[model samples]
Target: MKRRDLVIAALIVGGLVLASAVAVARLAGDPVGLLTRDAAASAGLPPYTGVISTFTVMVWFAAGTLSAFIAWTDGKHRRRLAPFAYLLLALAADDALLLHESVGPRLGIHELLIYAVYGLGALRIAYLMLGEERIVALAFWTGAALLAISVLVDVAFLGAYLLEDGAKLLGVLVWSTVPLLAHSAPRAAVPVLGLDRALEHRSQPG
Candidate 1:
């Protein structure tokens, strides 16, 4: 890889660190904030909003974006990445639609839609990364499958009877699987993260 590529990788990963720190700092003691928003609303009140934690939210957004970027850039030059690109764009767009609102049982249009887009994006990326290598592919698929199943459960199977059982698991899984899935593609970029394979291949003793 060129020196510039290393710089870009460092910057992208550095952004992850910065975003996570912001999230940790700002979301601190605010786990209940979303719930609080809803609780207040029950009594006919306005939502109690907090200072926008760009890092907290943007960290995940950046992670997803970086993963997609790697897949697209690499796939375009070496591997068809149009689908992956579209999904990445979808994930970023969905992030913009986040409401951070309090709700009963995680049932809200914004929440559902964001997670649905996230899951779809994840699955698509996982599929793209499926043949990269054994261990890496397994991890990626596991995350994607969990998230896709979770969303399907919530969106398609959710109803009065299944509501209690279905949505709970689905909602929980969606949030959990996303970060795992988001990190998978970037992990696949490990080999290319440093050495330019094109150069390394030519330089190898024949």
Candidate 2:
């Protein structure tokens, strides 16, 4: 990455860390009630879990947008990329709006829809990653596995809301790596980009 990009990333990471620290301090029974739970409630803020979830949603949305832009403009594996991009975008939307929670319950299919979306997305990503090197594929699959586990934790540990949300947040952080790694790889190395050669050659001389 360029120096400017690195600087921006550092800034964002720093801000998130600071925000998390503040949230944690506030949640840890601070008697002063500085950024307290009651304050958060009154101000319509989401405290710690909300901060993490918001970051997750933003990252997913950005990943989706970047993937879609790559799919549209890149010469290789555009068709395969479309699905991953759409999935990320869908995930981001769901996280931001609680779409599944609102709509699925009304339709009496909450679990089914969540499982279907996430499961299919993970499977599709795995299938696409087969073209990558073994290590890359392994890393992505691991993230996918963690993502599934996070959802399970969310369901199984509902009584422990903090643990459930933390697990889910951890999974999201891991899953965020897949797209970043994929983006770093060369476009020419993509397995399904054979057709891209003809297009590239069309622009060059023998």
Best by lDDT: 2
Candidate 2 lDDT by residue in tens digits, 1-206: 67699699989999886787677777886543454335456667666636766777887787787768777766454644567778878878877767776766777877657868778777976776666544446666675666676677666766665665566566656655555565577744643333344544553677
Q: Across residues 49-107, which tens digit of lDDT does each residue of candidate 1 receive? A: 31132222344355445555655555422231345445544543443443322331256
State every prediction's TM-score relative to the real structure.
Answer: 0.35, 0.61
Quote the lDDT for 84 in model 1.
Answer: 43
The positional error of residue 67 in candidate 2, measured at the CA in angstroms, is 1.7
Judge candidate 1 against the unseen true structure and give its global Cα lDDT, from 0 to 1.
0.47
Q: List the residue pairs that clash in candidate 2.
A: none
Q: How far off is residue 137 in model 2, in Å?
A: 2.1
**How many clashes in candidate 1?**
2
Candidate 1 stretches with Cα past 4 Å from truth are 1-60, 68-85, 98-127, 156-206
Candidate 2: segments with Cα more than 4 A from true spot: 1-49, 186-206
